[model samples]
Target chain A: MPNPDAGGHWGEFGGRFVPEALIAALDELEAAHTAALADPAFMSELDALGREYGNLPSPLYLAERLSEEAGVEVWLKREDLNHTGAHKIRNVLGQALLTRRMGKTRIIAETGAGQHGVASATAAAYFGLECTVYMGEEDTRRQALNVARMRLLGAEVVPVTTGSRTLKDAMNEALREWVASVEHTHYLIGSVGGPHPFPMLVRDYCRGIGDEARAQFLERTGALPDVVAACVGGGSNAMGIFTAFLDDASVKLYGFEAGGDGYGTGRHAATITAGQIGVLHGARTFVLQDEDGQTIESHSISAGLDYPGVGPEHAHLAASGRAAYEPVDDAEAMAALEKLARTEGIICAIESAHGLAGALRLAKSLEPGARVLVNLSGRGDKDMGNVVEYFDFADRKGQQG
Target chain B: MRAEAAFATTRAEGRAALVGYLPAGFPTLADSIKAVDIMIDHGADLIELGLPYSDPVMDGPAIQRAADQALAAGFRTRQVFEVTEAVAGRVPILVMTYWNLVERYGVDRFARDFKAAGGAGLITPDLIPDEAGEWIAASDEHDLDRVFLVAPSSTEERIASTVAACRGFVYAQSVMGVTGARAATSAAAPELVRRTRAHTDLPVGVGLGVRSGDQAAEIAAYGDAVIVGSAIVNCYLDSEDVPAGHQRLAALTADLAAGVRR
Candidate 1:
């Protein structure tokens, strides 16, 4: 709930574990973040950008069909309706603003599902700043539409072809690029995962989701929801919605991790559910590592939730028992996605579907009238290709729609 | 040969020490040990045996390629000590690795096993002084040297704190980038070394981008040691066969040694 101490230790999880060359830059970023938070002009500018550009205060819509199915009230915080069709735009806009404050002209980022990359590219285009995004070669293929979207937004997308060819490798490549260009380029980390200020910084930027949702839910129902749920990868969206409810002990929070095949199969990205404590991508957190501390490649049908490590704050939250995390396997998440599309006519990202699956399961255990809010983190338009392949839509009846 | 003694020996000869690096299982574990032997036999004053990690964010293309091959070939953390113990009698051996490997290996346990294996210490690229409390305690308890890095971007206070935690020597990163050979050495190296010297009497070794004898000689003029990695690793990677890698590694070591002595 509080900011990390001087050395960025969030109960011994988040610290700057990076090359000496990057220490100065991280320190500068931390200082700038501290300064910007206190500056009224900066805050006002960000708020205006959120309203005019990012479609701030995304709608909180009641899903009557989902509620009836779960025998409980269900509401969807529609972050999918935001600019760039994901929660990532909030963090990108915040970081892009900081990049300007730091007097940097170029920004670089790493992406998994390409939502973050596209959001960053969009922000860069708005600000007329140079942008480059590093995505794993595999993800570039899986999310080719998002890749093209980034390029069309005037950002160069570099395909990282290292170590598992996924989000982790893209981050590794971004760090490598940042090391050489630290003086003039800001590494606009897209998640609440990396070193020191990143986990805290990105979380703060995206916390608007929870802030607006909390107010709207309270205003509508005269009380908070019984549960809040979101998918956890690097955990930004989950953190974005969870932070506001941390103090409301009655409101239980759940983070659903991508369980590719299942927990037993060893081919999952369920870091908190099945992983051990270790360091990855600059933060000491729950990591899926081999016996010798080598990072094991994580598998997930949802590219956004396929990372082998979760955010440090989420690790701390899990360790402290403030929130519970569970694994939602590929089949369960896909089924939930199908249900949402059929019931509400809302096709959501596969990553968000994990949270939907977890929420549906949790809702069954609660009192019949208990309310649950799910963070729909992104739209499914970019995932149309993957969805088509998975469901084999061409073979299904009424495929024309 | 302990770290201080190794540097002292070269200091007595009025020359900088030549510090050479190679991953522990590149090519193969046996060939990597053989390569180290060839390096020492030729003229490497010290050895920094690399433990190829999965996410080597600080490595350049050459080292990344070799590390990838090493990891793919099933190289693990324990084999680093095997190579160190094999070559420790020839020169002081410092295991260069990321912090996660040591943390996962257990800090006290790693220090104990490494010390028992006749290894000198660690050169952790990611373990900056701010997060080095456990490592500092372990190294001290085990009487092992700890080498921390200083960079061109390091503030004066950071350099001082980094050197203060170091036991063997201070590593000065020549450039603001990952490790690889460059056409020219950094223009910032000399100033960084001078700043680091103001904090501690620890010998400063300049690393990153030094490949040729000319570059080695240039760094030797100011630095206490000249550290090279990618070029030496490239010797094995670019060679047609393992024996030829040994030949190329030995020749390069001798050239670097001559440059330091010049």
Candidate 2:
């Protein structure tokens, strides 16, 4: 994994910039986490749960059909094949273990993709903790199935209507809730973002994606993959897979952010590409902001990639030149999503489609045999409604040929 | 009209300093400006003019809703300067905001504008001293006060660092929650105030969960300045109309101000 600077910085990007009310809670969380890290019982229990509950070692597969189209040895890290159909399960389960450790019986979370919400609900159900999820009203409307899924899993889902009503707002509500309910609740942050120890703590739990990918890829390819790529919102999976390759100088990493329309159109969540360095939601990172230092509303077709800010570690990686980021426009991402399903029978989430789109762009310059691995972050089930409406699939299908 | 001067003046009067907060464009910029003047007339010694950013994580629903309305109404950062410039010198004013709004607006330029507009200092809810080397240096250059927060959870080392970095008074939290009024005063406030005073002779201001005069008086016993945010905003939030909100707010400010008198 890439070495973080002291005090939770990825460089100058990550630090705990939160209100006074949250500091004590963050300190308690950090102290508890530090002890848990050294405690073998905690590790064993977490590992056991990961194996039995999350179905760890999500397979690494070579996409023969995708390779031919891309003209590179394309591979897929099957995070989609995990328990929740995304990499989010890894994080929430770990946090659930920590919640139990801290003796916090209530759990709260913020979600954009609904993957994280579903994962949090799953963990809460497993542990029998009271679960409440804050989701953007727009996201709830787009990803209604996930909202139902969360409710089915025994979580109360709150639709936040404030400020563009997306991931950023949901996160803001979650932080507000955590501040008020810190005495009895644990805020299970879904990404490798937020303030001190959370960014680091989440990274610790989430590194398994990269760790498994590294071992699996090395065994199959006899060397590290030439490139590793994943879609970045808060950058949990991207950082998860990228960490395993951070120390390896030769293996390049890429994080593809959602360009909702395009960068120039001001409707996108391309924070690393279009954002300036600043603080948002507890951590100092790259954020989309107006010249006046106020955060701007970010847009994305994929709710998962619709955040105004990205993880601090991603900010540090970009600053340090360890990883590069690119923006994949909404149209381009959808096209790749369709292409991947048609070519390889893998209906990946639109979030993962951004990575596939970027990889396709990357393939045009590389030789046919060169290896590329993409974190297929999730399945397309929750996004079907959005996809259908966005593409006008039903209307088009209803029309006569 | 520096923050320290306001606290010192209040101490001389045998009362806890009454710090009032109003988000820059709540209801409207003109009304908010007029409202703060009324608050000052009633008894507010210091004003924390809130810059309404899109995500106000530290704020409660009342403040958050107000901020959302303000931002949605196109309350720009420059408008904060307008509010400060119009209301400055009447009372010591600090722009209470998150760091990103200041950073996205260049730190050097932000401090310069705030200072030029007669802003006494910043009460940054998010920016801590350790990560604030740039802000510290910039504030020093601009001769603006830097008010950092000290929570009950603050470690002794963290307290020392915050006290050293702060140029004005240290902002102490009365509770472990976002800004809002509560039924009872925080049990943790007195000890936190005593703990902070041990480190520095700088006046410690306690904020969060303070609403009524009874609550304010209890906190004022230990806190140098009792900061009221959500309670003040709730006047606007719960009122039938803007004018009523402003009127109720003025009355409440006076009530709280009287309670601060020893």
Candidate 3:
């Protein structure tokens, strides 16, 4: 794993930029995480849970049709097939285990698309811990199905109406809730963002994606893929799949951020693409902000990627030139989603479609035999409503011949 | 006026200092200045002029509403200095803000500008001592007090380091929550204050609660200063007009000052 410094400084991008009240809780969490990693029992238990509950080693499949279209080999790391239909379960399971280790009885999570909230709720149900998921009021309206799923799994869904009423606001409310209830509650951050230990911890938990894929690809192809791509909303999935490739100098890493409309429209969540370095949520990262440092509201058709800030490690990677981040606008991402569904019989989330879109573009530029690996981070079951709206499925409902 | 002088004067009077807070441009810039004028006239010994930012995670609805209004009225980072300049000699004005604003404004530039405005110092709620190296250097270079906070949940080691880094009075979050006024004061404040007292001789200002005069009196009994934010902001939020807000703000400040002195 690419560990941050002792203070969780990922090249001056990540640190404890939170209220002093959260310091003790963060310290305790870090200690518990360190102890948990060192303990064989904890590691084995987590591994066992990952295998049994998450259905580990989600397939690595070669996409012949996609490859034919792009004139380059494309491999899909099928995180979409995991339990909860996403890669989110991996991080949730790890944090839930740690919460149990710390003797916490309740877990609170902030969700934008509700994928993480559903995964957290599922884990909370499994562990019999009280779960409360804070979601943006706008997101609740957008991802209503996931809201129902979380509630059905015994989690209270709180609609945060504060500040822009989106993913960032949801996180703000979750942090506020964690402050008052830190004694017995764990703030199960959904992404690899926030202050110390969180980006590192979440990345560590999700690294199984890259670990499994790298070994699987090596065994199948006898060489590493030329490129690795993933969507970068708070950057957990990207970090998850990018960690194993950091040492592989030959492998190019591409992070596709949500480009809501287009770059020039002033309506997008392409933080690294068009943003300044500032602090948001907790981590010092690339942020969409006004001239005075106020966080500017980011827009995206993908609710999950509609956040103003990218993860700190991503910022470091972008700065150090280890990884390249690009904007994949909504139309292009949705087109990629439709292409995958039509050609491969696989419908991936709009967030994951961004990675696919970027990968396809990269493949088109590469030689025919060069292979690109795309982390299909989640299935599109939760995004059907959006897909319908975006593709105008309503207009053709009865006209399908 | 500086923080030390404010505390020293309060100590000489054998009373806790009354620290009042308001977002610098809430309602409007002119009205905000008028409101501060009313507060200083009513008995506010120190002013925590809040710089309105978009994401204030540490604040609750009362402060959030006011901050939102301030931003809606187009409050920017430089206006914090404008407010500080207007209210500087009246009281020690410490800009209570999130760390990002100062960083976005350029740490050295922010310190230089704030000091140039005749402001006392800063009360950064989010910037802890561990990540405050640049800020510490800048504050010291500018001869400004850097106030960091200790919460009820803060460890003794954390408190020691936090207070050691603080040049102004140490800020103590009486509760383990965002800033708001509660019907009851923190049962945890007295103990947290006691722990913080063990580490630093600086006056510890307890915040995150204390809405009423009685609550201020309760905190003042043990803490060196009674920090009232949302209560005073609440008066403005609940008022029918700007003048009414000023009137209620003054009344609340007077009541809390009297309670702190008692």
User: Which 10 residues in a row give candidate 1 chain B its minimum summed lDDT?
Assistant: B81-90
Provide the clashing-pair count of each candidate structure: 0, 1, 0
iRMS per model, in Å, is: 0.7, 1.6, 0.6
Q: Write the per-residue lDDT of candidate 3 for residues B1-262, one digit (tens) a residue.
A: 6799989899999999999988899868988788888888988899898989899999999999999998988888998888888878978889999988999999999999999999989999889888888999999899998899998888888899889999879998998889888999889999999999999899999898888889889989999998999998888789998789888888898899889988
Ranking by lDDT: 1, 3, 2
- TM-score per model over all chains: 0.98, 0.95, 0.98
Off by over 4 Å in 1: A395-401
Q: Which ranges of candidate 2 are over 4 A from the true structure?
A: A395-401
TM-score of 3: 0.98
lDDT tens digits by residue: candidate 1, A1-401: 56778888779788988998999999999999989989999999999999999998799999998788889898999999999899998999999999999999999999988888989999999999999999999889877888999999999999999887889999999999999999999999988998998999999999999999999999999999999999999899999999999999899999999999997898899999985999888888999999999999899999899899999999989998999999999999999999999999999999999999999988878998999999999989887887888888766675665
Per-prediction DockQ comes to 0.90, 0.71, 0.90
> For every candidate, what share of the true interface contacts is present?
0.91, 0.82, 0.89
lDDT of 2: 0.88
* CA shift of A108, model 1, Å: 0.3
What lDDT score belongs to each candidate, Candidate 1 first?
Answer: 0.92, 0.88, 0.91
Pairs clashing within candidate 1: none
After aligning candidate 3 to the native by TM-score, how far in Å is the CA of A164 from where it should be? 0.7
